[model samples]
Target chain A: MVTVHSTSPHFKANARRALGDEQLQRALTNVPGGFIAKRQHAKDKLPEFDALRDEARDLKNHTLAHLDVYLEEYEARVIASGGHVHWCETPDEACRTVIDICKAHDARTVTKGKSMVTEEIHLNAAMQAAGIQPVETDLGEYIIQLRGETPSHIIAPAVHLNKDQIEADFRATHTHLPADRQLEEGAQLVNEARQILRQKYIDADVGITGANFLVAETGTSIIVTNEGNGDLTQSLPKAHIVMATIEKIVPTLEDASTILRLLGRNGTGQEFTSYTTFSTGPRRADDPDGPDEYHVVILDNGRTGMIGSDFQDMLRCIRCGACLNHCPVYQAVGGHAYGWVYPGPMGSVLTPSLIGVDQAGHLPNASTFCGRCEEVCPMRIPLPKMMRHWREREFERHLSPVTVRYGIGAWAFMAKRPKLYRLATGIAARLLKLWAGKTGRLEALAGAGGWTRHRDLPAPQGPTFMAQWKRRRP
Target chain B: MSAREAIFARLRHQLAAGSSEQDRRETASARIAGHAANLIPARAQIDHGAQVKLFIDQAEAVQATVKTLASHDDVPDEVTAYLRKHNLPQAIRHGTDAQLSGLDWHGRAPSLTVSHGPADPHDEASLSHAVAGVAETGTLILTSGPDNPTTLNFLPENHIVVVRAADITGTYEDVWQTIRATYGERQMPRTVNMITGPSRTGDIEQRIELGAHGPRRLHIIIIEN
Candidate 1:
């Protein structure tokens, strides 16, 4: 029932198209202007921020090391709290399980919060195919859903859109509203959406959400959102279905707090989101208002393969999108250029791991290896190192394009012999310098159009780094 | 094999260390039961009075309005003033939460009409009593029961919460400890809502606009005497 559609194989074309899109370029400015400085300010305010990151990393590492037992314990707790736990090995199976649950409840319309896991499994399409309406309650998600496009950013789903584009989309879809009504300001758009969705939340039969963390100690699923859509989505419906991956488990509330310290500060630069709701199970006997049935579907979807692979550390990702915020490669081309469910440095490593390097090889190659992603990662994931691992895999499998293979082959041939490497680099540096003709930039390179197409490639100012190192040391 | 078993098998197979299954179970249980605290922010390790001041400062920084009253008895006066100042409805929807219901709203402000139960669709404002307030993030912790229905937190256009100054703690860890003690070991209320500021979204061009879906205004009443 769930089909994963990917354009990763055409990542180059996607990146090129994204670069030429003027509206996207305008929208992308929000990345550095908004996220980077906010994260820095939040980090600077707390003296123990780095120490908490270390604790968060250690907690995830410990949890992953004994993942099986911890998951077993977590399931038992969920059952004890009067919640159903469904284990799924694939996205299709997870989708099928959800459809069955909805059918059991005779649900016609299901409201949803912002959940990356559901996006990963393409839950909306599957639900639509089954004749169920999946209403996105999050303002960002609702905008993109109206446009019939996938999320371009993880945390900010509609970040790639400008106000004009959004206003146009609203006018086109919300025909019932006054056609000429003012929707110029951000608050106006928000208020309009609130008025429209308020009735949908009350009419929804089932609500599906993604958990930020699942506590093994008490079987609670927690969601942190600046908007309280996730709370209303789950609280008003007859049944609450939680769609989550297996790796989202933590040991206790204390551990969740440790990670929370980093998640908001690093992700949105807030101390905490507006609502961090912890739901244990179905509504209790005396509860006046809440869902009667609670179900949690634990998905694997090839992540179990990552458990012991070189990419196992990727499981520690909390989907903060800070890497996307800090990644230069991601900033230049935007997330749509990455061509998948996830798009960033973390995606560069993870996309290939989930869907083979042969198909997603361009993702790893997209990085500048500035090491900013790893530096900013709250979980301390070595993203550049993992991307390098994928590059090696791509080369070994002979899946890389022939030109890239030969370029690396020739470079490796020289790199092995130190004298020849220095000689070859020295000659090329001088050739490039001579070709510059005092302009100090190259308009184009013969075989590497990708390097010089957007901006002039800066000419080497001096000899190769190795040659300068030897001269200075000697 | 069942999907659950297969998934678990693959995980254990991939992560097959030398430890026995029993050993891993022991480790997990010990960890869950221990409920150990990690490195808490030094900002949260202050005295109660400082914590209270920090709570107010932190809460206000996030755009939540905080007003401290001498006692819970003065809550009705402030609520009426707030509702009138904003020109909101002369009524509020609230739950049967004792701390809120026990207040003398009828006597103190006869002009203001207050009702109880889960939130009504057209309600302009709602009120609740927070179990605790975390000073570090200026977040209020509300447990869902008949006392404070979860819907009251998100269903209205404006939300008002009253927290006793004594209940405000310095860290989320302190709140967790209190939860464990009140709910009994490893048990919790059906829902525990931790609210910070009001509803907001940066989804539109990354410009944060308040009141995306929930309340636009979050007014906090801290009883200090």
Candidate 2:
């Protein structure tokens, strides 16, 4: 139900607007609440957590190395269990397949769980265009849906909104209720959404959800959720459709357990999510109540290209959002500035790969390279190095802005001649010091107004690093 | 080529990892058949008593209330007492699990009304017997069957689960092993739900709130006997 135009190409403008919007600035203050501390506590408690991460990474590696066979095996197992597998090479095929399933089922209203793949394919938009109404069941997802906004955070879809903003949205949408009802507390808001969505769950003809992991060994799609909405959404419907990327596969239940050990700890610092459901086929003949139809739509939207490329290591990501939480840039500007479904360090490398570099070249350059993301990544993805790779790609293709290209060209020319570089830097450093006579800081610097506009840049001290090093060593 | 064929072809082109397709299929099948458990945490490798203690501790850590009963007979009393203590409704819904149906609710807790079926939206409480409990994360493994409907785990305000002490395992690996032994390899029930605690969400300004579209309170009754 989220509406997104993906202003990713205008990331700088989005960030500028985000930084200035007082409401968004107020919301950004809440982005870093105890996530870092909570993850650290969990890591300290479990000594084998890192070891389990290594094992999980290796298992995913093994699966990807033989991805073709695993996909075939998974398909066979799903079919054997009385489910259908729809292979989709692009987002269009995936969306079409989902819409076809809904139309076949005569689904007027379909309930959905929080799924990034569905977001990737714009499934809700597709379904809406096909005259099928989609209802988001996750509380966070529902909030964002009511407001007609994309998910700011993967796990917490409504992370960008304050409670008051949500209250206003609820008042506007739930107009049938009394005009002066008290929706004051978080619990009250949750209960209100719960009461409203309960009927939608039962009324839904088909339920769609994203898989956290697709186990080939048992032909099961696993979903981990703190809220139990996914269970209700899938259980109460007549049909269940699982939309997932091909990379979310583990060879066995044991491999899934290894990944499970890291997902929760890195994501929300919980030892485990409240519910981890492994759904195989639809309701069996003897089953009292469950969906009658089960379908798994496997999507490959540019992931096939990342298989053997330099960005291949990114596929190991479990979508934990730890990188987002630890990213300084993400904390400063929040998710909307990245202008897409995914944001932060992982998005920096992944956005360009999914949508070409020319459209999202700014995402990679937005990082401070603090290396916090790679440190906290459960899969040990080298995010900063990959961002540098994207920067290199941008430069090679001349995708970077004219100013940036010229600046880099000037710097590279001086760097190739070390003596000239030292002389130029020495003179510039002294000139900067003279310019910053008494204050020891420049209010504005030429060619870098973006940096000095809001905060003062510290003027250069005495001399360049090379000059100081030469005098000290000699 | 169809999307399936194109995807396969693309994968083949990218990952022609110096082996024939037959060899890759063999490698994958072997791995799946082997089904290895990679690492078991030290916390989960403990004695039975320690494991039970740890399970209780971890479950309570996640805000799930727990109590050890002498037997199933005591469950009726415990369930009634919990309902009364919390000032909840005196009725509970459950599937046709033998452990629950066998409890002499008529004889012991006369006021507690019990019903059998999948949970309805109006049901205030639901009960099911867990197939296994993992001590590593204080998780209960509930496999869906005709008698143990999956809806009972959700759709209710309060969920009461009964897990026998003997079924408690040290890690999720043990639970999966038991499942494989019970269900046979590569076969499972419609759904296998591993529930750690009551439904919760931190979506509202990252503030923790329980009972988000699922049971608000999860009361576990362990059969110590």
Candidate 3:
């Protein structure tokens, strides 16, 4: 069982530790392993990629606007197709419904596809506490599961570890294998885990997966994956459960196609994932294979409040992790430093909404506002704007520190008076130059010791911009 | 209140009924019923021969093997040859798909054994007939039913799919249209599996290793009938 003890409030502390950890720094260096280049290649292949992104964003907006109608229609179709739809307003209800389903079948073992929603709800812990052995079939999720850790990255859960770390994990867990077997390469580790999980797939009594999109037109739940773990997890089990949030619902299959064109290309830079499965319900009576029972659980959490609010655009997110891949902050600190299930720009905006700003105010403040996340987003979500919104909410709610409030208040005070602002900036620039000496840098400072502790801050070299402009004109 | 009712009520309250509630409901239902295609890529708009070429190119780009045969009778021989070349067993598990059942396996590979129905725990290879092939991404659409068992597509180490040349379409929109015509717009099979290549994972240090859980090798046999 994995527990989400979020260290989000201690983001600065986590980041400080992460920066100095040699192993983590080495792992983080491999963060840009062909992701940016591959995404560019995929984009180059499809000229309509941007146009498709626009359509996708608009489609999501339309669907979310009428989410109630689409959800209702989707529920009816699922029931008509011999499946059950369970609406859960909270994570506890979602976990209870899953456990109840497993208990009804007396499931001893349950296999799972990679699902962030399940991560958000901490379903594995609840299931394990109920005495059900939940096995993560995805390669990345499986590694993290063995280590009893949550995912560091949304797409690549184990991206924070190297092959050596994974090899050690495999050796420590798989005792049945021959001693001193050469488990050095990535291929060898993948093969070992594949052989170990194949038996678990057949042994499981129930399987739970997350839906990439739910089609209200045909009551279909779609999942896109490069590995076929999700298919095997759901197909072999006696009962299959799809755990999804309400925003996952789309109006029709065509709406799904609009987004599908962008999902793989943006995430992994593949034109399409190896497997894009659309499962409507349980197996037919005449079918030779498939789960006999199918259930769909729709969790709301706080998404219902997101609609018609300032944060509504954030709902267009497809969980592709493109923003995370391109984020400079994520590349430096890695995901765990963000201190939550989600990290990077998307996490910056979403974590606060899901877990309250007071608990996660540091996340929105962690960004450099480089806008790379927004530029690369398949849905074109205004991530920086949303982060700014979260900052505003934090400030309004008095969640920001006193120092930050005082600094802002002082800056706002002079900004209204241009003459005073110019005078203060001119004086500060001269003082900074005097303090910098020949090095032209500030190795230490009185008020902001935290900034200069690790690296020297560049001193202001000349007069302020306003002073220079006035002097040149005169 | 029940969770469902509460959720709906909250959403309604948040939406605040900007327009007539009846109008919003109608608009939602209308969009689902219409289900129009939006922004079909120009790459998938080529002619038939070019479409097949594009499909083959796309499939190969994703690390899948393709074989074009003049008839379905060549399927068994090709399957046997693939197995022999790879040092795999000459056993294939398959479902009741008519296109697959009509093939003469005994004539081409007399020593090969065939298992009918879903995949067993030890099946080395499996065969299924693709309902349609999308040329845009070289995606094989397999609708799950008695004819094509869902398990056969994922459990085996090797997967071979047979698709009629006429069934290969230009885009996903065309395939969706065919599905709508056959199963109605509001209905679908229990599972519609769109397979582009064999299973692979980039989890271990972001390195791609084929056959993570499903078939390590994906072989496509397109009948040019």
Candidate 4:
């Protein structure tokens, strides 16, 4: 597990490094055109996309409001259906419970689907530490796992890695495989991975997957995937464990359907994913093949504190990765720059809070407050507001640098009175333009080195827009 | 503790904590109403035959074959003809409706088996139905039942869905409303799947390829009134 708390400083340094890396800049240049254009095209085809979003939002809000009741109801139903439900208050507890389950089964190998909660808990490392070989079965996740990196994007984990990099990783990993083999094409790479993962799917002792939505009424967990890996993971293994956040529970399948309509449209441009599996319990008495034991670990992990807070809206997130695609900072630096499991605007707000303000404080400040993330967010989490909240929390905890705090205080004192603010702005604008000259660009600044290193900031042409507007009104 | 006593004690504690049980109940009810208002739209009169035709057209557009049968008795023969048309040597997987228990399949094909259990990936084709078809997005909702196992819809190489004309709805909202009416507030079905088209991905170099994971072919049988 990549701990955001421990890696905040490293992430800030790397993001600064990323700002100077021309190769990373070139790689990210296509993201806005690629994901944004595709999503717009998809939205244009469906006029009811906004209406569907509204429905999904409402459904999620309603479910969360009654989460306690629904969770108990779901627990009863899962028990009745011959499945065990375990409540975990923290990531360590969730991992311990899963490890215990694995120990009980004497599991050696575990095949895993693409699960965000498992990522949150860093279950793979824990399982490996316990002497279990955890294999990622999803194609994209498998690629990232082979490369020894965390998932950058939620939907496309290795979206940052090009075909050449993938080929290099494969060549380095697959030693017995010929180096001169013609694996230039993506299809060939996919087929090669498919052949490799087939044996793991069949031979694994246990399987783990995340729940997209858990139906409270029926006690069933829904796992949607573009690949059929989730099905094989849940079915082939002798024991299956579903690690999910508590907020994933919806009241019924009807409610689940309402959310599903928005999930596909928001995440990818698909009406539905290729595979949407709903497993209630272990295989039935007469059923031919499925896991003999089924367990659902509902993880809280600081989510309970978020339920009634200002950040409660974050719980409505379905992990669609829409905001990540539209986020400018995310596109530039990629997921690794965020230095956590989640890597975009959502991550900036969520990672800091889940970890702590002092440890991951730089994450909240890594944004321009562009509002594009909030615009594209499916659950409509006010990301900028949440980021600002984190900023306030950072300040209160004295997590911000002393120079930045003093500079902000000095600016605030000046701005408190109108005459002083106008006088300061008038002199500053003239001085900046004098330095900028005819090009109307400032290549460097006295104090702001971070802003000038990557790109030139344009100087003000004349009086401030607010000052000009005030003069014209008078 | 007795159930009534436990309930009363919990209610009393909530009331003592500056919240009332009635207030919570009213808020929950209001939230549910608000959700229903946003999710369930005004009912629109549906032309079921036209909706089925729309799904059939979509299926064909995605390069899948379609066949319609008069009754359960005609399914085996139609399936056999389908296999023969495709030049397949052996009968692949066969799926039946929950209402198809009495249907005779003794003479039509030797390899045909009723799809009752979980689907094996080797099955070339599996048959099922759409409980309702959303013409807006050209999607099909398949709720899990005894005959329509969710695995059959995903695990096969080819999917053959049987849709009755009356089950087709115009939009997703309409479909949800219909589902709610059928299942009511209690005892809802385990799974309700909305399948739009064949599985596809543009992940590798942004090139669209069918059958990246699930069935590449999606066949539909729209039985007309």
Per-residue lDDT over A1-474 for candidate 1, one digit per residue giving the tens place of the 0 to 100 score = 236588989998998898889999999999999999999999999999898888899999989988998888888888998999999998899999999999999999999999998998999999999999999999999999999998999999999999999999988999999988999988899999999999999999999999999999999999999989999999999999999999999999999989988999999998788999999999999999999999999999889898878898999999999999999978888888888899999999988877778778999999999999999999999999999999999889999889888989898888899999888889999999999978999999987686787689888888999878878994
Model 3 lDDT tens row, A312-425: 899999999899999999999999999888999999999988888888999999999999999999999999999999999999999999999999999999999988998888
lDDT of 2 at B87: 91
Task: Give the chain B TM-score achieved by candidate 4.
Answer: 0.73
Superposed model 3: Cα runs more than 4 Å off: A1-4, A470-474
Q: Clash pairs of candidate 2? A: none
Q: How accurate is candidate 2 locally (lDDT)?
A: 0.90
Q: Which of the predicted structures, 1 or 4, would earn the higher DockQ when compared with the native?
A: 1
Greater lDDT among 3 and 4 belongs to: 3
The global C-alpha lDDT for each of the candidates, from Candidate 1 onward, is: 0.91, 0.90, 0.92, 0.73
Model 2: lDDT of residue A257: 91
State the iRMSD of every prediction, in order shown.
Answer: 0.8, 0.9, 0.8, 5.6
Cα misplacement distance, residue A145 of candidate 1 (Å) = 0.4
TM-score of chain B of 1: 0.98
Docking tier of model 3: it is: high
Ranking by DockQ: 1, 3, 2, 4
Q: What is the DockQ of each candidate?
A: 0.90, 0.87, 0.89, 0.25
What tens-digit string does per-residue lDDT give for candidate 2 at A114-195? Answer: 9998988888888999999999999999998888888987777888888899899899999998988899888889988988
